[model samples]
Target: MRLFVTLNFLPCSVFPSPSFPYTTQEEESGVIANHLTKHFSSSCYLSTFLLLIMSQRTLLIPLSSFFIAHLLISGAVSTTFTLTNKCGYTVWPGILSNADAPALSTTGFALQKGESKTITAPASWGGRLWGRTYCSQDSTGKFSCLTGDCGSGKLECSGTGAAPPATLAEFKLDGYGGMDYFDVSLVDGYNLPLLVVPQGGSGQNCTSTGCVVDLNDACPSELKVTSTGGESVACKSACEAFRSPQYCCNGAYGTPDTCKPSSYSEIFKNACPRAYSYAYDDKTSTFTCASADYQITFCPGPNTSQKASQETNSENTDTNTNTPLINSTMVYEGALSQNGASPSLYGSVLGSHVTAAIVSFTVAIWQWRQLF
Candidate 1:
């Protein structure tokens, strides 16, 4: 005997055509037919078919849930960053991922002289990156940095912000209106000059935004961070030097109307026209790029030849020094839509198709057993 089964689990609206007909055939001419004829009664066939169906249903329920959850989670995308060090000295890079997000490769790591590192960030990722100078690890394994220290007493920042007088590269990837917003902010002060350039992207005024000028050279006397050798290692912000309401932009000067740019902030604005001068300097400071990779170059001034020479010398003398000037490129997947409707609809249709497939396979198995 032969058996034919048809599965009809999905609605007409889900299919491309008005209806989808799935059929399966079973024949009593296989090895299972001979075994059943010789060993089992007709009542056994019914029980066997029911048991098989139950087992299949149990397996498919979890599979369906897993598939659905996978689709929902896979919608998020990644963004790439190429962080380079152009200074003659080694810089320990520190990264702080956005709130509630996970940390990347390292919260902080050593980038040897003329070295670079690449990092990938998840969708809607926001964070800040800064360079820590004059860092050392003690015999007890506790680490400390001289400038741009996060106060963690360790190489890794562990969710801490850089101390004042640290140049900062801030980013918000795949953000509002389907664009990535980034800036090289000196609001915390400046230890080094960095440039943030967007590559392979398109948007209005999507040019590079940075403060390449060495603020440490022109840093005010009261705000200078000098080393033991009396060399200025970093530059402090006006707010750091004077904690008054005018410099800090607090109290009566908290609002944008009252907090006009002072002579101090104007200095930074004049140097880096695309960076935030004060708390309310967003009009010209904020920049947007759509689906772009960013390059953050520390100490990106007129030291190209110096950096190259140092890199070559370091490579020849220090065989263990493996960090190169350029890190590998990273590709972030996923495109975030303005509204949530597109992904939701896609998940729904995909789930329905998977459910239909399970139904067809189950029906086919059941029909094949019936023939025996």
Candidate 2:
């Protein structure tokens, strides 16, 4: 007795809809089937045909087992990363997959000003991305860069991570609870202004985050990395400069309770509150999203960085206060408001103080008249 079982599945085109969204379970299954059909041997297809010729009870057991195994083997949703360069000069972007995660197609590539590139990562892929500035080839055809070089002496970073003093965008996709965790880190130090914006995702903290300011302009004298022309290229962290256990968050200061933010770290925090200023900055730095693609932009715009530089300098004038130089919640359209107080907020505070003074004066006049 021949038993025929027909499996009905939606077409791949139906996926990525507004309601259904990207990386849904059905879409993953369909993608797996499509991939197998194109790559599987003809003998494999013949075996499936022969299985259909068996009896109803015998066919059901083996067919169900075969499908279950296929789904288990290739059932992960892929994520796409879009990298764009808005800097005036060319940027060589590098990618480094985490120890356990698989490598991507191209580990590193060049992106000219106003250019963009997209790369796809398999499910559960985790890695870091950064831009290499001042890259060039010498007489021997050896490649290298001034900042954020992976030390591979080649275009592709392969498995090597970016050297310190590079602004990094780190990601762990399809993480806990099927959510993606990402952060723009200045912990390793800041070389360029980087921003990570999630596309078509939903979460409370899924908003944009990064160091939009040009730290090189406002970088402290001790932590500044200068080029051959004496121009500041990158800013080094206190940990990188001093190599102390306290600044590195090691030894006695290993735990969060033990290690605390220092004056140097506060400088970075005051300038870019959304970025990871030090090793232990997690509360406000880390962001999460679900089923989304990410757009990583280097030097989002020129005006944003210029305004941030002015604010940072203004804040540095007064170092006695504990209050943050930048309002943590203040959001300007395209730039960061790093001032300790916004103009509107400052006006409100001043108005309240003036009213209190007038009330005291009126009471004093009344008392003097009564005494007379």
* Candidate 1 displacement at residue 313 in angstroms: 9.6
lDDT by residue (1-372, candidate 1, tens digit) is 223333333333332321211010001111111111121111100001112234234222223433333333223357788888877667888887765456776788888767888988876667788888878778998887878788788878887767777877877665433456677777667777678888766556455777765566466788889877676677777777787667766667766777778888777787677776665676777666655787888766553212211123443331212322221221111223335433233344355356545644665565455545
lDDT tens digits, residues 187-272, model 2?
Answer: 77888878888876655556678876667767789999887768777888888788787787766776677778889888888878
Q: How much is the lDDT of residue 175 in candidate 2?
A: 55
Residue runs of model 2 more than 4 Å from their true location after superposition: 1-76, 304-372
Which parts of model 1 have CA positions greater than 4 angstroms off?
1-76, 303-372
Task: Provide the lDDT at 61 for model 2.
Answer: 28
Best by lDDT: 2
lDDT for every model? 0.59, 0.63
Best by TM-score: 2
Pick out the ten consecutive residues of candidate 2 with the lowest summed lDDT: 38-47
Model 2 lDDT vs. the true structure?
Answer: 0.63
**Pairing residues by index, what is the TM-score of model 1?**
0.63
